[model samples]
Target: MEKKFNKVVLAYSGGLDTSIIIAWLKETYGCEVIAVSANVGQADELEGLEAKALATGASKYIELDLRKEFVEDFIFPAIKANAKYEGKYLLGTSLARPIIGKKLVEVAKAEGADAICHGCTGKGNDQVRFELAIKAFAPDMPIIAPWRVWDIKSRDDEIDYAEARKIPLKINRETNYSKDKNLWHLSHEGLDLENPANEPKYDEILELGVSPEKAPDTPTYVTITFEKGIPVALDGEKMDGVTLIEKLNKIGGANGIGIIDMVENRLVGMKSRGVYETPGGTILYQAHQDLEEITVDKYTAHFKQKVSLELADILYNGYWYSPLTEAINAFVDKTQENVNGDVKLKLYKGNIIEAGMTSPTSLYSEQTASFGEDDDYNQADSAGFINLYGLPIKMIAKAKEGSL
Candidate 1:
């Protein structure tokens, strides 16, 4: 049974799955297909995409450049909270999805399309991510996910189909590992990465991050300036969020700043091993954490640690458009109002050393905290303070003994 959708806006990447999906949607549903490629620092990934979409029988092709928007909006906001999934994995691929999905909905509404579609596999988090955003933006709009509906199961079959139609794709049988790249990071999975013990080979298949052994020997210094929790400059030069990040990627990548190979429990089910490259993000996260040590207070600082874990799940499982995410972001924004400062870091091999940190709103008081002849902190206050602090333990010990 073919459901009636007059026009469909497909979240097309011109990749293996989406390339086949464009042709499949045209053949199966008999609907007009409008391909929308989101440029979230993947402009290089869009090489000859327009011609390919046209050859695949798409009615039109649109390439939306969302690099600046992605950094200023999604990437910066997540970094503001210092949100890291599972303590090591930065939510790189995770954060980019909702922004793309949001833009897809906007394009769909503008085009007056009857339905929206994506090439996400049912097993992955992206299917949930894309669908949730679509539902949030247009609850009534129908979504056509080809991977779930199609009879073909593997990338091999998809490759064969593309070959049958003479569709030129960047990936092949040996080279293709499922990947998602954005401004913040690049993710690698769906191949030998399935095995927990298997070490990833440094091949062209994985190019986004540098290997630790291959990194530079010399230490690189980076001074990142921040204004109210947002990174504003690199070294001594003022730069925009996107440009600064790009510069950091080069510096950090050379020094092997961010690379993670972990067996993470997926949001859907089952544990999966994933390799990620988060060059700029690693530096930023380290800098943010360094700044937070001085800028954020003890209570909000500790609480934000717990909130960071929650924010990780919220981002990883793709609830960016939901109310919970909105509330969490609001809370994060409030706490970060005082997170203004600069962090100096020394990058050597795989280690990020915090050189120094300075913030206008810093709570570190020399008068109260310094050991060098501080007048404000009287020695007498500590005598009663220690008794009060330890009273509960003291009472418990005395009651247990017969001295209460």
Candidate 2:
């Protein structure tokens, strides 16, 4: 038995999964489906989505241009926290999910829909991310997750369902890799990626950039400017966050930067293997970290390292709308008050080599750090410091020898 609804708002992506979901929701619950797509930098993917959604049984279709907000609110905050899930993933998919979830709720409320639906599968982290964000806004709103209820078992089954229903699909059996794309990154999962033993056919699978072996022989140098830890400029030219990332993606992709393949622990208590291509994100992260090295103090920098781990888990586990996330973000914001600087990086064949870094508020003192004789730091003071630091060791040794 299924609960009845008058209308349902769906977080539609114009993908294989969601394309079938529109028809399924109408068939199962006998409700009118209103499809909403968030344009979060999925270049050219949004084209003809409205017509496709309507043709696939959606009563109405709406596309929200969330590109600017996605960068400013979600992506920039992740950069400030240096949030990397498992210390490797730039959290491209994880970061984008919350914003999309928020938009889905907004559209549902505006359209007077009774429930919200998504294409997230039962086994994936996105199911949690999307649901949690919806819960944050609409606590009692019914979430209709089709993958948990529908009979479609696998990608092959999904393709069959679409074909039988005369639904148009962008992917075929040969190239049916499950993917999530945004301005920040492009992720590839399923197919050969499901088996941990099979090596990812990067040449065949990569969409954002070329393989490192195919990168140009000459290195490309890029200068990134940061204002309070947010990237604002490329090569010394000021630009908005969206434009900056878009430009960097082109440059970084050409140099074969930001490609990673790893097995990650999902929030759902399972391990999944995927390859992520985050060309612009990788460059921004490396450049931001380099600037922080000079601008932030040692204690704050070390503590933020721990915060980075926690923040990574929070974002990956769909706690983006929680109180803990807000508090941690406030702390991260304070740390970035002084994180203003420029970092020059040489990108060559997937390597981000630090060329130079400069910051006006840099804590680094050339005189104190220089090996040559300097009056600012007393080298002799370290002897007294060492004695006091090693006092506990001396006491332990005396006790072991029975020397009172």
Candidate 3:
């Protein structure tokens, strides 16, 4: 017995899984399959995707150019929140999912489709990210996740099925690394990365840039300008969010600015090893932090650190549109109001060194912190302040001395 629907809009990537998914959707459910690809700066990945979808039996294929929107909408907000999963991973793949899922919902509604489909597997966090976004946008829309329902068990099994159906694929058995690329980052999982003991073969697997060992000996200098915590310019050239990120990717990659390998706790209660390349993103994060140090007050900066942890967890767990995320973003936006500044960074063989930072809203005062200041201070005033501040320690020391 075949389950039937009028139409289903699939969040397609033209990758191995989705290429096979389009045919499976048509054969298993007898529904019209519409493939939608959102271009979020995945340079070569979008090539021939439309024709590929159609050849794979999709009734229609729609590719949306979402690079600018992805950066200004999703990327900037995460930057403002300073969101990082487990303190190293930049949440690159995690951040892209919501925008892609949101676009799928829009396409499904416009096409008058009753269902939305994805190629995410049962064990992965992406399934939660995609389905949650779908449920958020269109609660009644049916979600047809082939990995969860179908009998296909592994990538080898999927490859065999694709071969049997005569579907063309970019991936084969030897290409072991599963990758996801967007403007912000490129992520690699599977293959040797499945084992924690196995070191990532960076020389072979890296797509965006060379490893630090292979980077040039000469250091590179770059200046980044931010307004309200969003990066607006790089190296004194003003550009849009997408352009700035793209330019930095090239500059940072040349100098080996960002590369991370970590074993992270997945949302599904399992550990997964992933290698992420975030060349431009790493520079931006370092620059933003430097600017914030001068512009943000101590208390607010401390409090925002706590908020950043919550924001990172929400993003990694795929709650981008939830009320809690909205609230935290609202708070983050308020903090960025004063975070306007320019930061100069020295990129050298995978190290982001803070060269300098300046802000009109900077809370630092040379006169107040100077050692030889003559005005507005009494040298004896520190004695009273120290006594009050250390009263508890002083009392504890006296009690111990008396007992001895």
What is each predicted model's overall lDDT from 0 to 1? 0.87, 0.94, 0.91
| Candidate 1: residue 323 lDDT (0-100) | 84
lDDT of 1 by residue, 1-404 (tens): 88877799999888788988888888898889999999988657888899889888899999999999899889988888889888888988888889888888999989999999999998888898888878888899898988887899899999999999887888889878988887788888877777877878755544665777778878899999888789999987998998999899888888887988888878899788888888899999999889989988899999989998998988899898878888988999999888888899999987899898888899999778876778678888889999999999999999999799
Question: In model 3, which runs have C-alpha deviations exceeding 4 angstroms?
Answer: 399-404
Q: List model 2 lDDT by residue over 166-190, tens digit each.
A: 9999999999999999999999999
Best by TM-score: 2
**Which whole-number lDDT from 0 to 100 does residue 111 have in model 1?**
95
Alpha-carbon TM-score of each model against the true structure: 0.97, 0.98, 0.97
Q: Using lDDT as the measure, name the better of candidate 1 and candidate 3.
A: 3
lDDT of 3 at 404: 27
| For model 3, the run of ten residues with the poorest summed lDDT | 368-377
